[model samples]
Target: MDRATWDRVQVLLGQFVYRSHQMRYAGELIHCGHCGSPITGETKTKKNKKTGGDKQYVYYRCARYNDEDHPRIRMTEAEIDEQILALFDRMRVEDEEFRNTFREQLRRATNWDLGTETKNED
Candidate 1:
């Protein structure tokens, strides 16, 4: 891809990361949505070890697959960001009240009072 396109992808991916951590999945920021593996550097392709069957697929990789300790399923940053945008589009058309309440929850939940448990760690 050209530099301009790549730059745009970076912006969208950044938004995806923020929205995912704050709006949807808290403290569970992670790899590509398709494979659930880390995106290494700016490379556009990854060797994805996909899981699930038929329509339920999860991509991931183990250490043995990549010759590295952190074996991550591979997917393009652009692809993953596109998925996030799709989600954002759907949520944008959802109920207005729901969106407001969701934002309110995000605000309240952001301030830590020592009682909050992370979504994945707990």
Candidate 2:
């Protein structure tokens, strides 16, 4: 196959694989606090009577949620996002020395030198 056709085939295959396993935070990002199991995402569609449409919602819950004596706690994606944001907010650095160290480490990790760069006004 030609280069363009091969690239298109690769892109289509990637999209198919992504759609087949569309859970965003299923494996590594979160775990169940109560059961210590990985959290999995699910999508649910609810029919809207007033609007005559279907509203889809994503939720995350423990993989063992179906097991007996589970906590039965399922959180929507929005709730998980809010919790993550709150966590980041709590992780803000107050000490100047620690902040500087963190900034340097982040710069090194990302291989970017923001301090030495100048912005163009034009």
Candidate 3:
């Protein structure tokens, strides 16, 4: 096969393998906090009004909604992201260098800078 065709085959094979793995182990992705039932993530895409671009939204919803007894559970991607940020924010290490690196990463992820904050406060 030609190089381009071989590369395309490899990409397709990789996607197929990834999807197969996800299908096999998808049950472990999320679970309902209340009833211990499985949850599935879904995504929706919409166009941005201001930018005229596509934006995707993700959420995890309980799979057992049809059941009468199980309470419904839904979580937005933003909420999950916030929780993850909070988790990273609370993380601490004994090493000073590691702590500084972690802090820098957090600031970068949040688009925050100490200089900007200081200037804003003045």
Best by TM-score: 2
Candidate RMSDs in order: 14.8, 15.5, 13.5
Model 1 spans > 4 angstroms off: 1-10, 13-29, 32-38, 42-73, 93-122
- Report backbone clashes per prediction: 1, 0, 0
Clashing pairs in 1: 35-59
lDDT of 1 by residue, 34-93 (tens): 445443332122233585322212222222336544434443223343454444445553
Predicted structure 2, TM vs. truth: 0.54
Q: What ranking emerges by lDDT with the best candidate at the front?
A: 2, 3, 1
- The local distance difference test score of each candidate is 0.36, 0.54, 0.48
- Candidate 2 lDDT, tens digit per residue, 16-89? 22231245456546778997888888777666689998755566789999999998788754355345434434
Q: Rank the models by TM-score, top first.
A: 2, 3, 1
What stretches of model 3 exceed 4 Å from their correct place? Answer: 1-27, 45-55, 69-71, 110-122
Residue-level error in angstroms, candidate 2, position 36: 1.5
Residue range 1-122, candidate 3, lDDT tens digits: 35543443343334222221122213445457777777676655667689998755455667786688876655553344345456555767789898777556544543332222111110
Ten residues in a row with the worst lDDT in model 1?
113-122
Cα lDDT for residue 47, candidate 2: 69
TM-score to native of every candidate shown: 0.26, 0.54, 0.46
Give the distance in Å from residue 92's predicted Cα in candidate 2 to where it truly belongs.
3.8
